[model samples]
Target: MAQLQLGPPPQQQQRPAQPGQPGQPQQLSPQAPRPPQQARPARPATPSDTPPSGQPDASRDQRRRALPGETVAPAPDETVIAPPRQRITNPTAVFSGLDKITGRIIAFDVAIDETVQFGALQVTPRVCYTRPPTETPQTTTFVEVDEVTLNGEVRRIYSGWMFAASPGLSGVEHAVYDVWLTDCKQSAPVIPGQAQSQPPATR
Candidate 1:
């Protein structure tokens, strides 16, 4: 049989302090390895953010500047002038007469200030003008027409300008006849033993 020895339930082994200062921290036990603390990442700058100076980029200013020895074009002339339109004047004005009763259409020429009879109407041209062949054909005449009554009485019917291109706007209009200007020239051809314009039979 052995003798039992129980002084104090065996005491934990203590580490002896090899300390230097008075308020120094003492080691308790092996500390658990701490997780490494990660560093915060820095933010990147954006293009939309304006700089402190508020000035435009140097690259853009260089593009706007003119290069040396560059040639510049001149501006075009602004004012434009046109030549005048040419016209031709004639001594005689030619006309076409329509007889609604006889269904006859006859073309005749009349000299300026001369009176010519067409059916019961007398035509007198005051002025006639035309354009050159190279230009547009515009035959215009200032004329007067008189109507003769059955009782031998004469009265003015119409008097104004007439355009050949537009016959409906002519100066002469009668119940049985219509006269429109056709052309303007120096003279008309003379027929053998016949006058260019037939005179009205003696009343």
Candidate 2:
């Protein structure tokens, strides 16, 4: 049986913080002022454009020299000056054969180092390249097929790079001889006694 109506509890009508006024000290709602930050347009400086993450990329000191599956290469100032090596000037290379027990299809011009036999198969020609009649006619002969054997034994069979645009792609697959690669010649079939050279007087 007790009733306490304390006198100071009635004086709490002091509430003027009413913007949203919950407990009274929260009147901070006036913020629509933030549209002033537009300045970021400046990237136009390329002599190559790489260096800057702590700054060190002069192309990592001109990175190049990592071939076999290459992570990256060719850039020592980006040096790719390889347009010079095209000199075969007619080193002669014409080959064609198939004399499988005399079914006879023989044709030979061989003369880069010159061997040329073609019955029991001799045919030399070490490198007789030819591409540049404005490119892509590609003749490539490297040849070297020995085979003398009846027990006379010479046997070297065939050796690489013969492709006058893929005559079976790399020749001399012999049962009786198949040979291939036909073209790339600067003259080598005039030998009755060899004396034919007269044509240079027209200015």
Candidate 3:
């Protein structure tokens, strides 16, 4: 046995571990000193010029407003309105009768509530009306027609309104005589002995 020397062991050290030191390494403990910490870089501030999130920009608000002294008219209503129709009354209704077999056409006038004879038919006008001259001309008449058959039977043939503007639409289809309204007037020149109103026949 050799004599032991030194107050501290070479394999163990109480100091903190140092770099580039030779021999046995030193163990770190709570008493060891720490290195100084570096300061963190400052955070950049946000731009004040830009608008905040979730908001409309200034340019959009300008478009919503009208220009200076400019008139902004209100929106127009969607409903549409129409004018009332006006019609004028007349005293006489002028008509044209066509005889299919003879191909003869006769023009005549009958006063309201009076009947005129044409061939075997009696024509009576109830109403005669017309539109204003400034407006579209439309002459109309409500008339009744009776056909006297060979058996002395006065059968009702046609009873409806007749339009002067469209004669084809108002006529007796199968009868030999067809009468259509031509015009409505206040008075018509008298045709001497041409048309005579018949008295009511006794049953």
Candidate 4:
């Protein structure tokens, strides 16, 4: 019978590394690699996350700064207030007309609501306004003109504002007749038969 020999376990037996192969690299069993930590989803945005109202944005100021050799446009002024509109108070306006055939100039005063015949054109003063004595002298009149045809038909020809300072700027453009605003009056002329109103007593 051969003598019984004691030896180490087969798993612990070491194999000799081949020549010129230096040393054998250690083999390690791979662990499933923790399954990539499972990144948490980001929270959703809410109304509280919004910036406060009327607060200026930081990025806007940075963008407004001009770079080297770059042209920057000016921002519009939003606070420019417009002047208040004025009211018209006068009730009568004087209009001057020229007759081409007769070579004569005739001036007629028309009430704010009444119409006057200027040659073939009917002149009606709708509004008459005069600036205060403290302000620059200016008179504006809104006039309406109508023409009558041979067949007894009436038609509107011109309806617009005429300035006293610049009479030629807005006036009737006609071949036989021309009309323009000249002055503004407080009251219309009293007729021959109509009774004149008494002036108010001094306070």
Candidate 5:
């Protein structure tokens, strides 16, 4: 009975532990989640952005505040007004009257009479005549009095400068002649069967 060896069985007594040992809380092992860091897209508000208080930036204040009478629009080539010119009140006079034997007669006839108020201009009347070394040399001729027959009768006649005709046919009769009277503008009216041509002597 003294030969009973029990040394191998005594190794089972390695369990003597008891003093504040609570170790079981380290769980972080699902490591495939690293894709959530993409947050950067916020920049689109410019006109220099941040002008809502008194509201002023319409491209930096271009000077437009004038509402009292308001008249500012004339610069395309700028030329407001300048057009009204043509005025002549009394201007037309040519006179002469002396008839003891047809010596000098041109007393009044130079016409242009128009009155429209703003257009159709021409008002001529201011001519008191007679100035030409006159005493007697009769040969003066200038006739144009186109039509005046109510009882005063003076029908068409226009003949200028013939002064005492008869220098080669025995017709002698002369005095002191020097006549000049001119105020002219004529379109038509001198036809008395028209035929008196002789004008080609210029030297």
Candidate 6:
């Protein structure tokens, strides 16, 4: 018989199976699990982002500083000055007299010539007299006229007449008598028929 040597009974060799497949359980390792990631903190504000506590508001300070060389525009709340109110007095004819009358108020009728068309007529009456000065007359003279209210009512005075001129009177209208006088001086009596014509250039 030939020498037959059996090293050992034929050992059955088993092959390791692949993991994560049907009927195969996955093998576990000894490594530790990783931790969750944390979010970064927000950056703090710098000096440029926040103004100092002692400083004024930025917008207001800018406006005030801009006013030195530049004109600061007026605000809507600013007050505006209004023009003085003008009252119409002496509407018709201006009268004058020679005597010194004081506190004498009278109403007079003026007869404007209707034949000749007076172009843009203007009349001025002044009481001329010399009086002793109580105080030294200042170089700058200021004249004020005292007004007399009629029956506690205000009447519109024109250039000369105490009341407004008659609406009917016109350049072609003749013999229209609507003139009146008021607030005459009591001490001076007006010289009647002593009226003098004034040149148109005097206006």
- Return whichever of 5 and 6 wins on lDDT: 5
Model 4 C-alpha lDDT versus the unseen true structure:
0.77
Residue 132 shift from truth in candidate 2, angstroms? 12
Model 6's lDDT to the true fold? Answer: 0.34
The models' CA-based lDDT, in order, is 0.80, 0.74, 0.81, 0.77, 0.36, 0.34
Give the per-residue lDDT digits (tens) of candidate 2, residues 109-178. 7778778777777888787888677655777777788988787788887898877777887746678777
Error of 3 at 155 (Å): 0.6
Best by lDDT: 3
Residues 1-203, candidate 6, lDDT per residue (tens digit)?
Answer: 79785553344234454677798796655485555688888777553455559876554565677855786654343466856443322212333221123334334322221111111222233322122244322111011122224355422233322212232221221122122222322233334778788868864
**Backbone atom clashes (below 3 Å) for every candidate:** 0, 1, 0, 0, 6, 22
Error of 2 at 113 (Å): 22
Task: Give TM per candidate.
Answer: 0.55, 0.33, 0.55, 0.52, 0.17, 0.17
67-90, model 5: which lDDT tens digit per residue? Answer: 568755553334778454332222
Q: Clashes in candidate 3: how many? A: 0
Q: Clash pairs of candidate 1?
A: none
| lDDT at position 53, candidate 3 | 85
Error of 2 at 51 (Å): 6.4
Q: Model 4: per-residue lDDT, tens digit, 1-203?
A: 89765886565567544445557664433664445667899877453455458875444554567697875543332244657556457878888899999999988888888988877889998889987775667889888988876777878888999999898887476779888888998876554468867999999
TM-score: the better of candidates 1 and 6: 1
| Candidate 1: residue 195 lDDT (0-100) | 54
Error of 4 at 173 (Å): 2.4
